[model samples]
Target: MDSSPHKLYHVHGFDSRQFLEHYFSDKSDMAFGDDVLKFPIEKLRQVFAVGHINGDILIDLSIGSLIHHLYSASEFFKNIIVLKANNRCIMELKRWVDERTGAFYWGHTSTLLQEKEENSDQCQDQEAKVRSAIQHVVKYDLEKENMTDPLVLPPADCVISVWLLEVISKDQDDYIRYLRKISRLLKPGGHLMMIGALDITYYLVGKDKFQGFTYDENFVRKVLAGEGFIIDYCNVKERTAVSDLTDYKATIFIAAHKEK
Candidate 1:
């Protein structure tokens, strides 16, 4: 596929609802269920259960309004602060958080997490836990040195960022810049769990095409080290589900803590 002449995500707004339907919906046939939903959840469940990566506060800055990864995390943290780049995402997420009408049904996702925990019938209970744990969802500007400046957020115990750099960053250096900015939000020795696509340059959400920043495992490690993080765990899952939505060869998960 040709990679040029694409619409920029920043210039043209994204459709968060369309995004959810195309990939995250359980009924969608775009990709197999394991790659999009279960893989990350299981990996995170393992990491969170290992007795590391915990504290009072976790600040989430994932792509779109994704909440699947938070199910494992809600079990560990006392408070989860979600930071978003746009109001649409904030509102979309709030609908689910508030249980407003027509909200995206994440019971399937809740059920998946529950099944992993061997609590096969606690889907409603699991959903309630997530809704209770996620106490705040605030909008922020990525371009600012302090993304949540003026609002004054407490330093996070861990920052969970998923596929955010794929669209917002222009290049590798830009990716590092955003990485550094979010790192400052962490207390020294605080953890960061990042999930990124390897060697992907673009993705389509609905009918609109948006850019995905290209990078590999080596580059990811280089950037993390340069930003003074100590790598504790890294996992790469090769893509098994075929789809026209994205072109990532594999999904990479890295858990690291800031060097104190």
Candidate 2:
């Protein structure tokens, strides 16, 4: 967006605890179980479907405040590097990784992933494994020449981006540009797993509103093909419309591999 960054609601304006409580709280009445939880569960299942994605390095270009996607990846990647858009999100994630005070509880999400994977039911064990796997939490700017500039990073065997481009991009062209930039960080033929909200324009954090780009499955397929990625798996889950927390019609997950 050409608009001033100050007017935009980036990670600093985001309240991590409030976001989780509102959308992912364990309350029985919350739609977290039905609508929100399926996105991560299905995404993780696709990761497994790819068959033996375990590798040395994994780069996460996701919104750092949301760590649920990392649960499944942590098991496959030996070293996990997370790139955040702002300082607030970095701090929020660090609090949980460092075991500091007032961190948002992600045990429920960890348990959900564990059970879905047929792993042990111990939530604490799963949490420990994720914490151990995450090696770094650093800053990243999608607009920068290199997403992780100043600090040189190794080409990752797998790159995971979830609900990031839609939130940061101003339009379709910008979204494709951002996608291509992130794809550059992957090793040739390496996997690129992404999750997005289909046909969403905006989402709110507390009283502030953040913009999102709208797109469909066909657009995603076309863009990936244009960017020289071979799609291995793609699917969209129709939203249940239980709450207006976000104005998305569906949740799309795609798993692709960069062509050599």
TM-score leader:
1
Candidate 2 stretches greater than 4 Å from native: 1-13, 119-124
Evaluated with lDDT, which candidate comes out highest? 1
- How high is the CA lDDT of each candidate model? 0.84, 0.78
TM-score of predicted structure 1: 0.94
Model 1 lDDT tens row, 84-197? 887778889999999999898777887788778756564457777888999899888877767777788999999998888777777878888888888988999999998887
lDDT of 2 by residue, 1-260 (tens): 22332224343457766666767767776664655665766577666656667789999887537777777777678999988888887888899899898888877776676566644663447777778989998888666797678988899999988888887777889889989989988999899998888998777656656777888899989999999999988878888857766688988888889999
Which residue pairs show backbone clashes in model 1? none
Give lDDT: candidate 2, residue 235. 78
